[model samples]
Target: MSNEVVLRGRIVTGSMDIADGVIAADAGRVTYSGPASEYRGKAGPATDNILLPGLVDLHCHGANGSDFSDGSADGARSAARYLHSRGTTTLLASLVTGSPANLVRNLSVLRTLTAEGLIAGSHLEGPFLAAGQCGAHDPSLLLEPDPALVTELLEAAGPSLASMTLAAELPGASGLVELLAPRGIIPSLGHTAAHTAAAAGFLEHAAAALSAPSNPTGRFRPTVTHLFNAMPALHHRSPGPVSASLSAARAGNAVVELIADGVHLAPETVKLVFDLVGAENIALVTDSMAATGLQDGAYQLGSLAVTVDHGVARVDSTGAIAGGTATLLDVVRTTVAAGVPLQDAVLSATAVPAAVLGLSSQAGDLRAGLPADVVVVGPGLTLAGVLRRGEWVAALAPTA
Candidate 1:
């Protein structure tokens, strides 16, 4: 007999949804996914719930009182476990700005964890950032894009460095974009005060960089990191990066990430972005930090002191919004509750992020032949269970 498990519920993938459906997994891949009535083989077990592809978070700092920049393997594992328990099967452990040496040390630590499957990859949130917009990161550590520094960090991270967030307007920014484009590492533009014209210029330059002959896969695509946060606000005359990012995404030239945790962006703004850019261009990320999944209190985000109160985390010295306190799952719930359709919201949390990381084929959907990472949730969107690679995660065991 074949080893298999069958999940029955309101099946939802990144693209579509089926009511009263069945998804079967065997040998760690989804063998079948369709209406239950159409499944001819033996059905394993069934539950009436919402079944979705396990979420993918493109930008996540830390969770469970563990910051990815803490330079400890155990701390990284704790954060990974917390994310996995919340149905985020794919996560990039994000590091904040620090000295070059500290960044390398932290990336080395996460590199080992990535090899051990604790994380999918690593995201360098900066050292190459605009000091004027360095929100939670220490502005003192911010530096201009230096090719040597970028190369060193990438070498230390090995293949585990999947993404980096930088300011598009800074001197030599386009050169950094060119360097990252052919490497399959996503070049995310953020923490900047770039105006609309400059943002668009960098987007075009980034696009051209990926078109080089050296890049065979042609998978390089730029992204807007945590759209709106850490960037200048959109104004009628002085339209900033937000407009440029939205326009790029609308034209299928870029992918934009939104925190959408109600703390990072207003509920109406979240809905408007969904309406304008649609789900395919938008990815929902938590940008969560050490304060996530913990009660309101003092916390640390990289080298800066942070305080979380009323579930919002902010930097202590500057009172800037540090990061988010919600998981990717919680972000999905918040987006859906804010009037975005559930299917669209789920796609932003799953397919969009996976696409941004160039991992859509292996993750981001519930189709046959894909990895059997799935999430089961109650009618109210409460996570009840999680499965990673066809194996049940005991941490999210369903509750009665």
Candidate 2:
């Protein structure tokens, strides 16, 4: 008996495109992915649908009325199920600013979920952030970067701490980056008011530290977390963090995460970033919270009051735009609709994010020998079916 599953559709891998294609998997790993006419293995039912590699999101707080900061196992699992159903098979559970004790407790919950394969890992977006640019994060909870606190959080999170967002201009920011870079934890720069020189200096130091021969993690590439959101815009004269990040990405030393949800960025801005930096240097993230996949209403985002009205989530107290309500799939669709090429948008949503978290070889693209995480979508990018590990996640199966 052959444990093989084949899906035929208009296929779009992170790097390749096939009009009439067949993707065959054996024992939960893709064995072949290419043109159906060229396939030598047994073929399954075929359909004139669109097939895509499952999306990978680097920064997501929660979805489906479940928040990762809730510190509840059931809530975390519910979020995972909802995201997976939406074709996001790989996601990092993001946490917002909170007390050290509360953050540690939430990390424990995320750790269990990550160990159970419910999520990729935890993303701490964080207590070590600048209050001036905290966005929807709780200003009271924001703290200056401290190497000791980072060490404590990492010890608590164990191997489940995938990444952290810190203000690069803070007092202990460099120390935290140097400490975490070699340990395989991605040190993302965000929630800052750093000038161009300060921000560029941070990246230079981080690049040097991560590339050192003695570093256990090889070639660590730090990311600009939710670029242009919490940080200052790229002014012609001031430049700021956004400019430095763009320079680093263009130099192939960094990758930038963009929340392409229309509410977070203007369509022209999104298109401009794509054109300037190219898709390979960008990862489209949702940066979503519990309000995602829900109707417009009040919600909580890490101890902050959030309200969603007409699909835009915002802080109730300050009216500050909160985390996004869109999913990674929605972000991809929005990016493509905003003039980015379809393939480029898809890669930013898929492969680029996977590469950010060091999961490129395992989950990003539709390549042979990788886990069979695939998605079937309609013309408008609406998900019709999803498969994780070669097994259908939703009720819709391929029809003959």
C-alpha RMSD by candidate, in order: 2.3, 3.1
Give the per-residue lDDT digits (tens) of candidate 1, residues 1-400.
6668888899977777998888899988999899888898865556669999999998999988889998989988888988898999999999999899999999999899989987889999998889889999998899989999999998899888888898988999888988887777778889999989899888877777776777654356788899999998999999999999999999989899999998899999999999998999998999999878888989999999999999998888999999999999999999999999999999999988887777888888999999999999998899889989988886722111
lDDT of 2 by residue, 175-215 (tens): 99888887778888899999998888887777777776665
Q: Candidate 2 clashing pairs?
A: none
User: What TM-score, over all chains together, does every model reach?
Assistant: 0.96, 0.96
Q: Give the C-alpha lDDT of model 1.
A: 0.88
Q: Tell me the spans in candidate 1 whose CA falls farther than 4 Å from its real position.
A: 44-47, 216-218, 396-400
Each candidate: what lDDT?
0.88, 0.87
Error at 64, model 2, angstroms? 0.3
Off by over 4 Å in 2: 42-46, 213-219, 395-400
Q: Where is the poorest 10-residue window by lDDT in model 1?
A: 391-400
Q: Which number leads on lDDT?
A: 1
